[model samples]
Target: MIFLNVALKNIYMFQDAKLDLSYPRKLPSSTVENEWLEDFPKINFKRVLILSGANASGKTVFGKVLCIINNYIAGSSINQSTSWLDIKKVMFDKKKPTSFKVEFLTPKTAQAHKLAVIFDQDGLIEESYTCIDLQRNEPQSAMYKRLREFEPTSYYHKTKNNHDITNAGFTSVAVSQGKMKVPSMWNYRLCEVDNTSGSQGRITAHDTNIIKTFLSAFDSSITKVKSIAAESYKIEFSNGEHVLIDKGKLLDPDRLSRGTHEAIDIAMFYEAMKNESFGESATFYLDEMLAYSHTEAEQSILNLLIDTLPRHSQLFYSTHNYDILDMNLPVHSHVFLKKDKYSEFIQPEKMGYNQNDRSLLGYVKNDVFGTLPSMDAINNL
Candidate 1:
């Protein structure tokens, strides 16, 4: 399933925060629709999302919340797991039920669904699911209009307890067997500061090559990456510097730079995509993992990912790299997060910056979008 829109409510510090993946209609779409699914020819929803924001603007929080919601949709976890308590003392402090509205597409089923969920500390209290009768070659706007016109009786309200409301998504053999929601192919990776690089998942010859090329771009001192074992890796530096991973744990981690470490984590994500290369649909989110890499290398990686991903997939990338704005990409691909009372996803194209002639980087640098970091504290210090 592909996420089109999502909203969070009643969660502490995250009330009514909406994330939209829809491409702005007013902007001229790419002649080559790499970011759209062929199943919905008239509806060109975004397939690549470049998320940028100031520090403390909730980039990691966005990925974390989406991960939980993905789990909720897949029936892997529900009822707002206690694990969220560690996020913040303020989280879940309110008496109100944590609620969400999710709009997604299950293209294999040839239908789109809108989900409404309300859950308390215990379990799910109320939830509703509505599906649009997808017509062949119908545009998203038209389909939504038809959904609105459809009778209310078609809506599928959850009948059971929260945990059991698992049967909420596409009803397939997987759902019948109590495995998971159908088409559950998604990945979420946190940055090095927020998550440990666990054994750099699914190492392979492909990942090793990609890792070597990527690491070399950032640090030319790195010469080679070779597999030492099923999970171990040997990194050889030209200056005779070496780093070893024995069964996925870095030995003498200080010998490894933060940039190289995150590259390994990113290679893991690549490994994931490689495994799913043949799959129909997938979703991947990487949060600020490219912090140490140069914008040039980021552009290369972004291009490679765009080429590598399946046609029916979307990748959400979060970073503070403004250099990316200089690249010739659609303004709709970007969502800038700024926080006051809560976070807001600002779409430049949606905000009337339609033409590609203007300088996105300049606008951002000049604080036109108001996403530039405030230097007040550091200046005062």
Candidate 2:
């Protein structure tokens, strides 16, 4: 999705804005709420934020929350809808209905608030959120329209009074599924772009740029040059190897056996981030960013992202891989996640550890984040 469609003003619109697979140069010492200030580090970034957590540690939930906030700020009515009234029941709906709320930021126009889509476990959503001014607790219309513009039309088209897709406020914002969320055409589009240079109607031009830019960062041993004809994609290799995969094969771009191809894709993503012009104060998040690379290659990509990208873009990521951790990137960048018996996920900072400590992962493995059984219980036998 494009935000405030001001032509590259929002970095979150780019796929490369996914995640920065590096260590944090700095961490937020604390977070403040309701006149109480905690020692949370104030996180600042010229690049994207990276997040780490184990399965069900709530990392993805956190990302969705941020996107929801972004949408609320952009303006989409997601809170006033009736779908959230019976949250637990609807969330567990075997054939549940998705719940969404859209609130106009201002009563006079559609630009003051944002939209929220909450997914309930069994089926659709159970709760929705719309911006309630932090201070006034009221909605704004103009803001809602601004944020609405970034969401996919399919999401809002089902709602009443939201058919307008050309409003300037609606056109400026953009949002997409996080790295884990896949679109059907994702793979085909990658193969097509791998064979072609420009996006030119095949897909979003910026997305196409991101693909080419990411691929060029790999070692020359891997070649991504391709030719497109008859609505098909052809990927060529420098070693005289050729494989024609389906368009949808794009879902797992890094699943290929060759490290070079995986490296090339990761590099391309990094290059896109490095070369991005996403002005100041934009945010991006990618989930499980290290799936495709060797530790060394992941490290190379991280270095470029941290050192090379413009300081305007902020990034975040979620991953369970420790290869990224052992890379000696930085301590503050690492956020550990673990789950409790209650099925609740916790972060290192939440469990009373100095988030800035390099030993964070060590503690996580030892059940510091609640992943380990009690020592007494284990030794009882």
Candidate 3:
């Protein structure tokens, strides 16, 4: 399952923001072969999303919100998704309901699902769900025309003093179909690469080679990586000295440079994705853990990840590196995010950039879309 679109109102920093993953209708779909399923070519979704923006410009917040929605759909959403969110922005004080509208496509079922929810401080208040069919041989025009006219199947609202949201995830009609075809049938894996000093992961023997090879590419001093225990390994250097990672803890982590430290974390991430059983359910959300790695190395791995994505999977990557704008990615594949009074996800293709010959990097560097850093405070200081 891939999310085609997500809209938020009164959720954390978002006042009214929408992130649409579907490819633009105005642009030709000729270069987006990797963007859609082979059987469902009419649904041109944006498979690879390279989110680049200024600092604190709502990049990380967007991913966290999406993860919360994913968790809520799976019926395991925790309060932590909004635990640290701003209470004022959440509208709890104003007694308004935070709302979300999601549209996703399940390739296996050859159908699409749109789920809308509204909840207040008391808990969930209302929910609505709708399902649509997409035949394999359906014409593009017919499919899009039906999409615009999709009517909601059901919408429910709670009466006064009804606050228990535990029995609620989807409406009654949505779950009546035996949980297989409903939104809950499928699950997604949304992981953010947190590469702090004390990060942990079990690295067994089978993954030793892949880990070693990827790390060695960044640092030439390492000779071999041997699994000394169930979750421990010794990264030996050519200088007869070595580093120890026991039970997933990198002891003496400061011995390595910052770049080498990032490499270790990325090695684990790469190994996991390389061997993952990706399908409709496995989605990836990667924040920039390559702050210390070389640009070329990052680009190579980025390309590899895009090339290896299964037909039904999607990758949402976030970064502040302006160098990434120079990559050969399509304008539609990139979204420039910025903050004014409210956060917005600006699509380059929709910003009147229908022509593919323009330089996205140049436009961004010139602050054309207002994604560059605002210097009002700095200038005053």
Better of 2 and 3 by lDDT: 3
Q: What's the true lDDT of residue 324 in model 1?
A: 75
> What residue runs in model 3 are displaced by over 4 Å at the alpha carbon?
25-33, 80-94, 139-154, 160-206
Off by over 4 Å in 1: 24-32, 79-93, 148-180, 192-206, 239-241
Clashes of each: 0, 70, 1
**lDDT per residue (tens digit) for residues 35-110 in model 2:** 1101112212223334565555556544543443343333332232342212233222334333333332221121
- TM-score of each model, paired residue for residue: 0.84, 0.47, 0.83
TM-score, candidate 2, is 0.47
Task: Give a tens-digit lDDT track for model 1, residues 182-292.
Answer: 455677777643332112233344557876876676678989998877767788899887888777567877776777777777776776776744265767788888788
Q: What is the C-alpha lDDT of each candidate?
A: 0.67, 0.37, 0.67
Decreasing TM-score order of the candidates: 1, 3, 2
Stretches of candidate 2 off by over 4 Å are 1-49, 76-221, 227-234, 244-255, 258-268, 271-277, 327-330, 341-352, 355-357, 372-381
lDDT of 2 at 69: 37
Model 3 Cα lDDT, one tens digit per residue, 288-361: 76767788888877777677665676777887777777776777888977888778889988878746655688
